[model samples]
Target: MLKNVLKSVGEYKKETILSPVTVALEVLLEVLIPYFMAVLIDKGINTGDMTEIIKYGMLLVVLAMAALAFGALSGHYAAVASAGFAKNLRKRMFYKVQDFSFLNIDHFSTSSLVTRMTTDITNVQNAYQMIIRVAVRAPIMLIMAFFMAFKVNSELATIYLWVIPILGIALAFIMTHVHPIFVRVFKTYDKLNNVVQENVHGIRVVKSFVREDFEEQKFKKISSSIYKDFTKAEKMIAFNAPVMQICVYTCMILISWIGANLIVGGTMTAGELTSMFTYTMQILMSLMMLSMIFVMTIMSKASVERINEVLIEVPDIANPEKPVTEVANGSIDFDHVSFSYSQNPEKLCLKDIDLHIKSGETIGIIGGTGSAKSSLVQLIPRLYDITSGTLKVGGRDVRDYDLEVLRDAVSMVLQKNVLFSGTIKENLRWGNPNATEEELIHACQLAQADDFIQTFPDQYDTYIEQGGSNVSGGQKQRICIARALLKKPAILILDDSTSAVDTKTDAMIQKAFIDEIPDTTRLIIAQRISSVQNADRIVVMDNGRITDVGTHEELLASSKIYQEVYYSQVKGAADNE
Candidate 1:
């Protein structure tokens, strides 16, 4: 885990190295300052020599300034290193997500990914800065102060030997108990994020159902759970300060009482006792800082594990070593193909799909929900690889071709139509970035979207809200179809994309498909019989297998499934009238 996380500290190695170097320099000067103070007190003040006092005091002032300079430099470099490391870490995670296959993405929830990128990374960043600066300085400062204390008078320094062990046991107990609570708290954070994202995305449905009160109650429960967990963790960590205070005060009182008696006995000098008091404060203060560092490290350990999971995960999909660069033609052949989202063959979602489609053929697929109609088309683009058998697109195995080359040749308009927030022209250009204004209007015209688009004040230049929320369902579908048309792909698959449009508009879009782009192989999946009535051939799917295949009239006479669906829809329309 440590090795994986440190890989993202690229380009910031100098800053990371400089932070600790400066911190060590600052600690050196700070530890020496008290020693010089003892010298000025003993040799200069005791003898009533003004010259000796001036010399040592001037040296102390110069050392103090150097320490301040080093401390400031350490702070600046620590900030730069940690912030830059976080930026690089986020960038790597985001780009890794982009490369994940559909199977890879299915394993993680959207809320979990968002929380990891934002909150988890932030925690790691803060912990890293503290580790480099405070963690480095505390132990060094403690050792230096303890050594100087022993040099002044070894007897008083022995007081720390017992106190240090007592503080260590207390801190270790708190960290062990608090760490499990912190781990649970971060998992609760995932649930909190999930609630917020779901509520915001489905706000219209929530308000329409009059469930605002219910949502608020749900949010409060998760929020309260997080609060309870944090409070418990904090209560445990709060034990550290009191334990440190007890040790600090006990050592201070013992040293004062014991040293005064030694001074009166003419064994210990007053100047050495004073310096021992200063070193005692420095040693105890260093312990306090170390305790804080341990607390932060415990809290961030869970975050580190979560972040490292993403950084180390290998993508399930990648391009072939020697990829085929070109697609031969629109022709696709699925020979003994089978698929399952899981690795176990017993859980196959599609079974034994064997079909051969010629270039420029228009095919329609119809099935009940979960029949894997969409799954069949998805394989052609290598969105999810077939578990067994050969799936070919453009007469070459999809896995053999470069991923970008194959996907570019096959344009798929998914069941759930999506449009990003942009102008109509800008969204259309996703299919073809260099598409001219003329080409944009032409694609929309073929999809029968140009008329509705021109009705708006800004026409093609109008801004679309996120997820195309400002547009009606039918308008969104037509716009998406227009976007797909701009690709001019060799093969186009529409997975119930026209369901929102009226039958007349659906017919017009189909007619335009036949009139223009005659050589493009088209696969249309729909629930309505009329949508596929004019296709060259229709495929009926059931339980992950093909039940029947024939043209419209032949299917009406021969296939039981097709006959039932066609008549049911016709009867429903007649009853409405």
Candidate 2:
């Protein structure tokens, strides 16, 4: 996990290396200052030698200034390295997500991924900064200070050995108990993010239903759960400070009492005892810093695992070793194909579907809500691979084709029309970035969107809000259709995309498809029979199977499912009239 995460340290290695190097230099200078102070106090102050005091004082001043410079440099380098690491991590995770197949995305949900990239990465970044600076400084200071204290007097230095073990055992006890709570807390954070995202995205629906209180309750529940977990973990971590303080004071009192006796007995000097006191503080403070490092490491360990999960996740879909680059035609052949989102044979959403379509054919599909109408068309573009049998597009297996090449040849406007935050022309250009102005207008006209767009003051330059919130549902659908049409694909699948538009506009859009793009194979999925009634052939589906396939009039005569749907719409229309 550590190896995978550290791969993102790409160009920041220089700063990462420099941080520790500067910290080591700063620590060396710090260690020397205490030793020189002992010399100044002994030979200069005690013996009344002014020259000796001046020499050591000058050395101490230079050491202090140099240490300060290196300390500042370490901080700067640590910040740069950690911030750069986080940027690289987020960028890599985002690009990896872009390459994820639908199945991979389903495995790790949107909310979970968002938390990993933001909150989790931030935690790791902070841990990294501490690791290079404080983590390096603490251990080095502890070892060096202990060595100098032992050189001064071995008996007082032995006190640290006993205190170190006591602190270590206490820290270990706290960490082991707190780590599990932190893990649970982060998982709960994912739930909290999910709740906020859902409530924000559906705020209009929530408000229309007057369920603000209910939404608030939901948020509070998740928030409260996170609060409880964090509080529990922090309570355990809080024990660390008191434990460190007890150990620090115990060492100080023991050294002070023992040193005064040694001084009276003519064994230890005043200057030497003073230096031992300085070393004691340094040793104890380094251990305290290490305890803090331990706490941070425990917290970020869970985050590291979460981030590494994303980093190491192998995308389920990738181009074949030798991929077919060109689609021969719009002709598609599904030979006994079966599929399941979970890739489970027993849970298939599309089953034993044998269908063939020629290039430039117009086919209509009608089905109940869960009949997998959308699932069937989604397979053609390799959105999800089939579980069994062969799905051939342009006379080659879908897995054999380059993902980009196949998707470019087949444009699908899904049931939910999505528009980004941009001007109308910019959104339309998503289908073809280099589309000419005339091409954009022509595609819009074919989708029956040009007339409405021209009414806007800015026309094609009109800015759309995110999700096209500024536009009506029908307008959003028409604009999406125009965007899809801009692809000039060999195959176009409109999966109930025109449902929001009036039947008259839907008819005009279909008519334009036939007149303007005769060579493109079209598959239209619609609830209303009138939308597909004029197709060359209409397919009636039920429960993941094609129940019948025929022209509209033939299906009306023979297919019970088709006749039922047709008569119900006809009866509903007459009643409304």
Q: Which candidate's TM-score is highest?
A: 2
Q: Pick the candidate with the highest lDDT.
A: 2
lDDT of 2 at 571: 99
Tens-digit lDDT track for model 1 on 1-577?
9788878899999999999999999999998998888899888999889999999989999999999999999999999999999999999889988988887777767788898899989988999999889888999999999999888888889999998889889888988899999889988999999999999989999999999999999999999999999999999899898999999899999999999999999988777888888888889999999999999999889888988887777777779999999888899899999999885689998999999899999999999999999989989988898999999888788999999999999999875788999999999999999999999999999999999999999999999999999999889888888889898899999999999999999999999999999999999999999999999999999989998898999999999999999999999999999
Task: Give the alpha carbon lDDT tens digit for every residue of 154-259 in model 2.
Answer: 9889999999888889899988999999889889999999999999989999999999999999999999999999988989999989999999899999999999
Q: What TM-score would candidate 1 get against the native?
A: 0.96
In candidate 2, stretches whose alpha carbon ends up further than 4 angstroms from where it belongs are none
Give all TM-scores, in the order shown: 0.96, 0.98
Q: Which stretches in model 1 have alpha-carbon errors above 4 Å?
A: 43-48
Clashes of each: 0, 0
